[model samples]
Target: MGQRVLFIGLNYAPEHTGIAPYTSGMAQSLAAAGWDVGVVTGLPHYPQWQVHAGYERGHQNRDIINGVPVERVPHPVPGNAGLARRLGMEIMFGLRAARARWNNPDAVVVVSPALFASVIVRLRAKYHGIPVLAWVQDIYTAGLTETGSAGGFATRAMRAVEGRFLRSCEGMVVIHDRFAQYVQRVLGVDPARVHTVRNWTHIGPSTHMDPATLRERFGWPMEDIIVLHTGNMGAKQDLGNVAAAAARADQSGAPVRFVLVGGGRQRPLLEELAAHAPRFEVLPSVDDETYSALLGAADVLLVNERPGLTEMCVPSKLTSYFTAGRPVLAAVEAQSPSAFEVASADAGMRVPPGDPRALLAGALTLHGQWVESGGTRHSGGARYVREVLSRDAATKAFIAALNAVRTKGHAPTRTTTIATLNN
Candidate 1:
């Protein structure tokens, strides 16, 4: 048999969440690269913890997505904010994934944010004598702590556990360079063991939609300027500033209208605030077609991450925004690596995070500049995504890392030294 690769992820398609796209894209890419690929995942029930409309409950439901075998195993669907229930879900899925591997022993990759799942993969790797690659989308404990979600003794214990489990992986894939550095400096992981594989936008049909069609569909005034923010609206987003900016822009008699899309814990509150502002519109969660069309309707894309969260998280939406070819008006920490990327690409401007006045000022400045130069928001970053961040490029990098691990004939070593950042 050719080299078989197994991918373990918390979310997979038919799930409609952020992780699903990445997991599905990576699986397809690996399959296209000639590796026999299998995905072990929990039953589809993310964002809404109920089995998707049609999938039956099961222990080993197998299906083919883009020619790769996907095995869906049963796991609990914990409601949001129940620690015990959430941990139970992770443990159940982990056990099922580990058991599934016994029948198909192969090199494995584990995606994280499910802390218990990482532990399970480590144990399974050791038991099966298979190599393990830990794909670190976010620094677990640090993310919780930075977002104020974990605290006191709980945070300490979780950190200790997370550090140990992360160090056990045969290889680690990180999305940000700062995270790689933090992992090396804090966890003593060797730099070489960690590979920086930034997230990419999987090219899809209809990425570009006609602006007039989008405007007509949304009932937007033909001459009004639209500034859109799309993605999960959670505590980490700090959207009050976005509202304040909208109010400020409106007061100044600017034609700019703000559109907020997607749903999360903070959606209700954002809706309440937006209702009081005539220039702002809060849209219900939309299906992919409508979502992409909405994005295409924008004059500017607004990205806001909570203040002080730069190193703790990276918004995956940036890739999509860039691919959509819209000028970005990002409100994030000045020091954030994401800010650097936006600035370096000359896509748009970045203001200090959580500063409504500054956000308003920056938006106005960009609007003025766009009008003065008679230039529609245009940037070469979409070309960058096509050339560097496409699914094919991500697959090549992923396979190279996997091959390196397999060739060493031993568990991969870790290195802490920083490398040049890839755009």
Candidate 2:
């Protein structure tokens, strides 16, 4: 029998956006690679922040998804979860995960975003003498800064707590190089233990769909350019800027229809803002087929971030956007990881965040390119996806990292003690 490996994460399959897809993909890929794999995750509820259908708030469910055994625990799904509520949800998940049957797996990979939960799981793993690796999707300290959340005690407490847990991990996997740097530098982790494995496109290849037909079916004008932003409309996403840009386009009579498809805490606010903009449309999340078709049909894919949010995340949508062979327009800080990904792939244009005029101008420029190149111009993104974001490559690298963590027989070497930075 293959070596046993277990994944502990808060998100999993059936929630097809955000971190869930990646976690599910990684877990399944490991299973396919001949490892005995199991997952301990929460009942699906994300982006919408409401419990998924058929999942009760107090029940523990077990199921097999794509051949991987999954054990799910109940966690709070706050309607509009603020920081305290979000933290509470994470803490609850942590407590539940700690109580779940680990079955003495060879190694444990814990996903973070539920930073507090990871700490809890890691502490428990230590008790069992199981090597623990951290799959850090985002840094909580950076999140506090980017979201303009209350700091001081909260920030210091998070940094110290996160630092202690991360440093103690047998290995850490980060999706972007920037994230690795932050983990090593800011979190005081040993550089050698941090691995950079770029996230692959979790969505399958999009089947070809005629743009005109899709636009017609969706009631989008044929003459206008379609600018689509799909995924969470959270505060960090700064979709308010997208709505503002759409309103500007409508007011100026630009032949562009801006569409947002997905849910988040900020969706209601975006709907209100777009109500007066005839060219703007807001749609709920669609099935995978429809989502991929929409990506194929759109003239431009967009990534918008709050002006000051330079870290904490690399938009997972970019991987899908790059694979869709469509031009991308990023409205974000130039130095942010999302901007770097866009620029690195040569996928699309970048405009400063929070500037509706700049976003409108960038979209117009991409529209011009779309017209001039007959829509075959986004080869850069396609090539980058093929070259950099291959599932096989990512899976192999992650498995190697996990194997190292599982096989390492000695204590993790520590470089520096956790620093309590006071701002």
Each candidate: RMSD to true structure?
Answer: 6.5, 5.6
Q: Distance (Å) between predicted and true CA of 385, model 2?
A: 0.9
lDDT by residue (251-350, candidate 1, tens digit) is: 8887778888876667778899887998888886567666666666787788888888767666777787787777788898888877867876667888
Model 2 lDDT at residue 109: 93
The local lDDT score (0 to 100) that residue 146 gets in candidate 2 is: 77
Q: On residues 291-332, what C-alpha lDDT tens digit does candidate 2 reach at each position?
A: 888998888999988998787899999999998888999998
Candidate with top TM-score is 2
Give residue 135's lDDT in candidate 2 (0 to 100): 94
Model 2 regions lying over 4 Å from their true place: 376-378, 409-423
- Structural similarity to truth (TM-score) of each candidate: 0.88, 0.95
Q: What is the lDDT of residue 104 in candidate 2?
A: 61
Single out the weakest 10-residue window by summed lDDT for candidate 1.
414-423
- Error of model 2, residue 221, in angstroms: 0.9
Candidate-wise lDDT, in order: 0.75, 0.87
Worst 10 residues of 2 by lDDT: 414-423
